[model samples]
Target chain A: MMKGNTRGTEAADGKGSGPGRFLIRARADTNIQLGIICILIIILMTALQPRMFLSSYNFESMAFFMPELVLLSIAMMIAMLTGGIDLSIVGVANLAGIAAGTLFGFLAGEAGVGGLGTGAVILGVGVGLIVGVLAGLVNGLLISGLKITPILATLGTGQVFIGLCVVLTGGPAIVGFPSGWTWIGNGKIASIPVPFLLFVVLCVALALLLERTSFGLRLKLIGTNPKAAVFAGIRKGRMILWSYMLTGALAAMAGILLSARVNAAKSDYGSSYLLQAVLIAVLAGTNPAGGRGNVLGVALAVAALTLLATGLQMMRVSNHLIDFVWGAFLIAVIALNSLSARKGL
Target chain B: MRVLRNSNVVIALILVAAMVVIGLINPAFWQLSNIFSLLKANVVIGLMALGVLLIMISGGIDVSFTAFAIAAMYLVVRTMVAIDYDGVILPFIFATAIGGLLGLMNAGIIHKFHMIPLIVTLGTASLVRGLVLGGVGTSNVNIDEMPPSLIELGRANIVTLERANGTTFGLTAMILVYAALAILIHLVLTRTMIGRSVYAYGADPEAARRVGFKTGRTMIFVYCTAGALAGFAGLLHSSMSWLANPRGFVGLELDVIAAVVLGGCSIFGGRGSVIGTVLGVFILVMIQNSLILMGIDMTWQRVVVGGVLISAVAITALRDRRSPA
Candidate 1:
């Protein structure tokens, strides 16, 4: 708790801190330890499968695929900061994409590929973002206004949203997103993939929101202790509602990129990403009970997981085994962290 | 003030109302055939729900029971197929044993690390599932390879009804198995000393520890019992279906948890009952099974279920808040 507060102050005045203090902070942070692990994984994978892992083609694909998971992970992190989880994020994403994709079907009819103008794409995306925000708003209402538990409420909403995805498309992929729309997922700014650039820009923007804003600080206080936050007059319900909406918007952004990358949206697309995002968020040291997490930590966790997944695939390890490895990794991290905490005592 | 009125009564009324509504929508839904099938479907999910109810009563939440169920089911099926064993009793026992051991692992981690039960179980669930698929191989055992005796047991029923055209439906004897187990659980939770200890522990873990209850033992027993139930359900599901897929029972934890909560088992723990839970399971089973009878498209089934879950909890939560029970 003391360390959390110190870091709160550190981040608040982080602009004044020199590189020396930064190094100390890095050493003090578990996320930086995770960063070292990420480095180790990259080095090990490159050594083991230089031909596959080191290729520009592999890197390019990674750039495209990694952003969706990264975005999802951060979305999850924000919700966790409020001591709640949005199990509906994956559902929200698919629903948002389906909104955009289905709009394309309506506007362009049978000729949706390159037939639509850039304006049509923007309009469709706008509808998708609205869908995402609205989904988040409902989750916020259920959790805050109706007083339902976050996990259960979101789980139910998730089911409803995923069901709506199937109802919308009727059990098939909605293909034919316009070329310009796909560019958000596929295009490059300089040599970097557009998705990755978007991911970086959003992460920075979110970091600022969390670090510099009253909303972020209040969320942290609520996460740390809800009663104390209430005592301090934090208007907990409004904060929770907004937090969920933000989570929804982030989920929608990830969904839009995902469908664009694949050029289609389906009900079951990225079905595993929900739990995987949970795993990633917890691995980033976001307290599951709420009150603590950061963008940098999430970025590192996403990097580590993406690399590990790619490396395992390259080595011909089945996806199931990789999941097993991730589960094991989570427990091991918990155990090791506890052990280290004991040693400090 | 009596904290809140017994939610058991409230939920029971809801369950009956749902049944009546469905029956009104489709007269055929009242047929013994549909009811029998519903009971059969309820067995797998119901067993798992009963086990989770125990965990929740201990102030712990688990999302790993589905993993345990699948693991036990897949491992037992794989072994039986390999060894050419045919007896139904042995597979159930083995499945129960396997599930108990996996549950022990979950208890061990949560106990040793003092971590959140949900996250720990989630990890173990993923890990165990991975181990089964990766180490044991991810192949579905075809019906032809299934043990003859096992299939016979799964197909066994107390009574069979012949349709006008000659098709038949049986009230799967599995309902008896479910009833027998549920009765045992109900007795344990009500008539036994350990059961009272579970309630005390859930009501306040710290106080329970200070009051001299064996906290660790209660946790172990609760999780082990739940895990064993999951394993039993998993194998029965396979046998009843006459096939075992390595990827079966995905996302079932949420459903069972939903049922448990609907039954009035408080998510915060120390409050639940078997009768209420059974009724809750029946409600879910009816909703899912009667989707066909209601003329609802299959794709919309989940939406209906999700909608019901959210509203039910929301209503109950609002009521609870007024009294702060």
Candidate 2:
């Protein structure tokens, strides 16, 4: 890993006469642009609803919604970095939630109130994580071992996961978790939401993983140019598999949190989040074609979009129109980015 | 010998095997009436599959067709109801033209930006669906006001079979329409100059461009044609089901794409056929129908379809690896 870092810095310095200068400058530009977008959204939203938008209650609610979007966006960013996509993230999340919810139901029974125990929560969460990992493993095997295109492979597997969820619950929401389970989703630590704290911890961990580890560097190399990475003696398939697995695990964590927050699990829960996750990742400057990403950009993008959504809801805009705005926003952002890239900006 | 290695041949074999297995499980599946009804039920999907095949062959994809279809169909239906118009041709024209216009929107953006078709279409799909849902509101246009001609055309049968138990089965005008469209598309894809260019471009866009192929125009043509077909499918669906709900055809892209891919169309583009898509549609519809006949739960249908998609691609990939194409 140290050798890899030196090699990267040498290439940067050889061309630009400084170690990390060009890369850091480019990243700083992206961060600055994203920061501006965030501040602009805040100002615009606050202007629209001077009192409600800036209220502490609004912030708390936004905090509640931000974790799942943040986690899903991060998962999507990782997959995009590998020049692949996991369309199955939503499916994986729902499946993991359902698995955990079912475990809760089994331990607590239909009433789900008196049997609340800490052990049951731990067991349910464990089951959810394992299911998520297994789902990821299947996706990894299909993409790496069978040589399937990531998009189509995940699309198919996503359907299968959703189908499994539907079959398990018979097309109805599963509600019956012990009250203790809510702590992960709804409880607070030091006046901050637990889910938000978890989001921060995971984001920091992911940043460290991507920046400080050999695996992350290799994954990026593979994404940038597979042939070049292969020439450099990296095992491309293994890295791709690991990247997808990591995404699947993250998706499961989001799912578990969602189930805990809502106190119910269903196949269709967070179906809308699928496209939103992609939207957030792309907006955060995760190149859809792969090879470039930043955690800070993703975090800021999530904040901006969440603010936009919450503001629209407060203004009484229909949910469907909000979806339209998201779609239009994605296209506009991508077009602008492409135009700038073409101009070599 | 060459036919044995053909991907179409492989798909045909799979379809035949599936049919045989289903037939063995429930011999009623072999009934001509059941088959015709099945074909009729899947005609909308079949038509959409043709458009998808064209896009795939031309090196792009449009998952937004379902949204376009529903939007066009709803517009036509709502207009007809508001004016109390009964003409069939006008509705069909309105639907197809609206669909084509939407496709043109997609083509314009994709061409200008040179974006990935999948992501572009994904965004457009959301935009289109959102516009319809938000603008039109979530309400079903009831069939009480449907034109007599449309309903009659929907029910018009080419042939009928009388059974011992008073049950009857036959092919509808819609099925014939589907067959005609399939044949027409097949001919156009195989015989026309534009079709050849589409194939050439799909095989290698840069090389085709260097050779002076009008890649942009061909892309527009492909997407517009797809949108028109989807519009037609949407109208057919409403005519058959007797309502045009804003939510109609939501998530139907998955079925259409799965069918086209199962028909041996390469997702990477430049490889597929109209006949292969027809066979693929049959295989999917058959699985669905057979599952119902066997009293299997409806949820399992998705699992089966998803499984088929994965296995088909996996098998093709394995074969490609062995041959090193």
Candidate 3:
């Protein structure tokens, strides 16, 4: 908002990027720091209990978790990069999964639809994905078009979406999904989990879209300086809408897979994912301030979190303990990030 | 016409209309005893809303408030019962102190470590909740041994007004607490230097810093105040219910947040008042009460609340569109 741009002027005057450049480098250092921490954690786990930490079962569990956790983080990353937070991701996923489950139930019923057929299930999942995108659209429209703060906008819509899911299901779980649908959740390709593969593929596609696309540039510019971007002929409102929608769609994808894996959909689906997805985003070094971060970091953060949870489970820790540990980790990261941001990093 | 469109005036009108409608529909709802009972039930939440109002005005949030309160309640109840401390004031003071300490921890983490408030609060929320649950074990704290005097204020109205229809309404400590807090917070916001600093900080922390505000220290104070209020609310909750459930205030942060937002507080962190928050809570509670009178089921209650929450935000969003970011 200031007329004089210190960072831009320094760069333009050939002052070797100045303090702002150093700040960017420092941020990159933080990423490397997080990476090292992850490796060290893995090493410590191995040294403490080699037999258990390196077991095939642990790896298998991690593989199974890769899809939902990674995808959720990616969704959050997209929103974060756009200088907005999608508090509704978990709600959207829950609603989408419920939609799929409801559709499966309807198709299986005698409403003139085939029972448990591949075609019916596929159609149901497709509709579920659309529901997710629609949820995002609502969030986007309310936030960008109507100028609502992202937090309040999503909070409101999230409640509505969650309530809708409850109303649709009457607060029950929908089970008896088709066997073929489980493949999306559990099948393997070359001994690698299908979901994990999808996770990797989504990361690559998103990374490319983010790093090498005009859309990505626009988003970064908007995030860094919305007013400047607007002055530079960028459509800030439209981009925000698009990003929220993308986040919604990605969360929906995760929801669809979750429904398939669990073989059911419940009204309260994906409630636990909120804290986890947020942690993944923050840990991955995706600045909630936006215009920074990449998918690779987010992917690793997801791995680290999932590992932490799995390790705790392997150590036979109680669910309550696991929750506490996760919370402590989140606070630690947030505090660390905030300090770093203050240091002009 | 424009004056009539003022949200506060409109809300006041709505509140008055709601009371009249409820009174007409069910005179029983207007009974002094029942009215006080409802007011008591709302007091704890109303107090928490006041705390939240401060945090919201200061441009930070503590989702962990509920968790902190739960932990405090556990400590207070367990200590009171275990130590055979008969006096209510001492335990309440200790609980409030513990709650304040937790708030200080949250502020310390954010101010000292430089982390996002939401993430820090969320993590702390989970951590506190987990610890409380783990400490309590599978069995809920038995309040059968609770002090009767403390329990009575939560359960029975102190002042009753009887009607010819054999129904009565009464004033309770809960209402007194609410009214007192409302006045206190309003005065604090309007009359105190710290309160002005809160607004200035929220309005523009960068500017506040330039103007020589004690950003870190003030945040600690604000959060601690919020924490203390939450603790007091938790105590009241336990006293009223005569039990401290580990799952108390589950998803209550959302309700508080919704109330604040609906009361026209900007989630962006500046420009809200305790009066607005109280009104927000009142509107929400009134809606719930009205729905019950209309024979609306609990299942539909969620839908109605959700709709109101979204609509409020949407309305705010529309207003925000007219202003430059």
Per-candidate TM equals: 0.94, 0.95, 0.91
Name the candidate that leads on TM-score.
Answer: 2
Once superposed on the true structure, which residue ranges of model 1 sit more than 4 Å away at CA? A1-28, B1-4
Tens digits of per-residue lDDT, candidate 2, B180-275, equal 999999898899988888887777777778999898888898999999999989998898877788887766788888888888887656778998
Better of 1 and 3 by DockQ: 1
2 or 3: which has the higher DockQ?
Answer: 3
TM-score for the first chain in candidate 1 comes to: 0.91
Alpha carbon deviation, residue A288, candidate 1 (Å)? 1.6
Which segments of candidate 3 are over 4 A away from where they belong?
A1-35, A110-115, A338-345, B17-34, B135-138, B145-149, B161-170, B317-325
Poorest lDDT segment (10 consecutive residues) of candidate 1 chain A: A1-10
Over B5-74, each residue of candidate 3 has an lDDT whose tens digit, in order, gives 4667656776788788887877777755655556665788888888888988887777889998988888
Query: Using lDDT as the measure, which candidate wins?
Result: 1
- For model 2, the stretches where C-alpha displacement exceeds 4 angstroms are A1-21, A109-114, B165-168, B322-325
**Docking category of candidate 3:** medium
lDDT of 1 by residue, A40-158 (tens): 99999999999999899988899899999998999999988877878899999999999999988899876645798899899988988899999999999998998777767898899
